[model samples]
Target: MPSLVDYIIYTFIKIDDSLNKILEEYDRPLRARVFKPKLSDSEVITMELIGELFGIDSTVGIWRYFNKHWT
Candidate 1:
């Protein structure tokens, strides 16, 4: 069985790979807005997916869990 950390890492890898493939298919560069985000889109998606998979409902709950435990 995979541990929590394993799941998180796998999710991130899959998301990042998918995003890269998508960008390549469209021939578009990843452009940031006026302000860059602290985390990448893949990271954010991984966090959200993990949170939902584990039944974490609130954004703050997800952030706190990852911040305290994963970080």
Candidate 2:
């Protein structure tokens, strides 16, 4: 079985690839000129996926888990 870190990396890559393809086809801007987000959409999605896989049901709990462990 793949390790947790490996799974996270794989998931992020797949999500990013899919998002890029959709963006290319749609040709739409995801953000404005200023106020960039701290994390990319793919990163956020990957984090949430990881949280769900590990049974983190609350948004606050997911944030706390990643903040404490990922950082």
lDDT of each: 0.87, 0.90
Steric collisions counted per model: 0, 0
Candidate No. with top lDDT: 2
> What is residue 23's positional error in candidate 1, in angstroms?
2.1
Candidate RMSDs in Å, in order, are 1.9, 1.4
State every prediction's TM-score relative to the real structure. Answer: 0.80, 0.88
- Across 6-28, the per-residue lDDT of candidate 2 in tens digits comes to 98999999999998888886656
Q: Model 2, stretches more than 4 Å misplaced?
A: none
TM-score of 1: 0.80
lDDT of 2 at 21: 86
Which candidate number has the best TM-score? 2
* Cα lDDT of model 1 by residue, 1-71, tens digit: 99877878888999999998888877555775889889998998899889888899989999998899877
